[model samples]
Target: MNQLPFFITIPLPDWLTERLAVPMHLHDDEARMRFVIELSRENIVCGTGGPFAAAVFRAADGMLVAAGVNSVLRLENAVLHAEVMALMFAQARLGSHTLRTGGGIHELVTSCEPCAMCLGATLWSGVARLVCGATREDAERAGFDEGPVFAASYAYLEQRSIAVVRGVLRAEAAAVLDHYRESGGVAYNG
Candidate 1:
């Protein structure tokens, strides 16, 4: 009989490490979305994972907390989406299960709108803001299923005190998804 593993490890690609070695302080929404969009594009160019990326940042000062690219195909875990990975890393880095602590407020920025699982995680992640680039329609057009996200989803987040901002750089972010589809990228959820 095969032994059962008790622990799970999700590793980021080496290129991500190299890219994050520099200090990043994006002071505005557009800058942060552009950075996340670049990471999504690079994820495709490097053939590492899905064409999606997310980052958690200090809302007050624009200091980066953590960043992640979609690792579903690479890590063989369907739940390892970019937003989940970023929130996980951010929680680990801050040594708290929730980001709403006395230290400071944080925000999550993603290259594309989050799916149902990621949106649920965002609410539990305790981030004060949720910033998105591309829309669910953009992802769907690229053959990806966004999974039950709707206008009420934004309302739910807002009701929970999480400020939701969408379409920060829609054109650039949607272009990445289009490029991924054109280049024969797999839509794991489709």
Candidate 2:
């Protein structure tokens, strides 16, 4: 379990599929679009429907920067969950936790604003965290249930995101993200 370096895993919730479907992600455009497109393969193929688009301009203007996927997606559980996990693992491997907090104005490194699902994926993705706001403040913005979110989930007969963490503390991620950014760390945006 500890020796696995080729795989990264992040947890997912029952609603990730739907959440990912929404257009106009408020943060990094390229990363959000790639995540949504990859997760919506079935919907895209049918052509009957899908939220696919070349660009989703939600924040005045933005551009796609990075893209990637170094893991396999069985979709046995849910594509969104698998993708998030793999991405997270990749970030940690690249050492994205150098940006620290509490240094007289604590450089925020300007992390992208994560939408609800992105927030969930970002936090529980097994990557480090960044401090966006206060504990309760951020939680209110997440708009999801309480978390120290896990990698496995059960969603009736449909599908669900997987859990990837053991004893993940919610704020722990924020702290880590903070370091990742200020220390010149980077994320895949995919």
Candidate 3:
């Protein structure tokens, strides 16, 4: 199979595909599950972190899988998370899951709470999973007209959702933007 280079090295689309179809979208369920774990490791405080902290995972074919976040991030630092979304998307693109390979593909995206504008980004990640952090009530309140809905957020704003996460080669996922001074090629594997 063909493998797309990592975001650092490859010329990824301006946006990832998180649409709804396969091969065209950006996320899926498997990736979403892993995203939950990734967010937890990032010290985002799943449920307690705030309302803004959330993760969105999709299939390689742009399918919505799972979304989780801490309500505090949403309530307090919406803009900060909003700005960091580009990072999250890049991470998701570079971060591949078992589902993202072969005839079957998968992808994921995660962020704290983001308003209407962010959704637009997920729509482009070319994945099947469409998941993010939102209060249970908020999810219910928002009511996705898309399809079968799942909750990645908390209801109490204090509750947390837990899921196992796994991924590919870890390069500078933690390092700050300045860390990549020379800018090595991406380690994308499928």
Best by lDDT: 1
Error of 3 at 75 (Å): 16
Q: Which candidate is the best by TM-score?
A: 1
lDDT of 1 at 77: 94
TM per model?
0.97, 0.23, 0.29
Residue 80 Cα positional deviation in candidate 3, in Å, after optimal superposition:
3.8
The sequence of per-residue lDDT tens digits that candidate 1 reaches over residues 1-190 is: 8699799999889999898889889999999999999999999999999999999999989999999999999998999999999999999989999999837999999999999999999999999999999999999999999999889989999999999999999999999999999999999994
CA RMSD per model (angstroms): 1.1, 16.7, 16.1
Residue-level lDDT of model 2, residues 75-158, one tens digit each, is 332234222443443344344432121111111101122224444544443323222222323323333223332223212101
**lDDT by residue for model 3 (1-190), tens:** 7697464322211212232123323344334434443443333322233223233333334444333333223344333332134334444545643233334433334422334444443444333443343322332233312222233322311232122232221212222111212233111111
Better candidate by TM-score, 1 or 3: 1
Give me the runs in candidate 1 sitting further than 4 Å from their true place. none
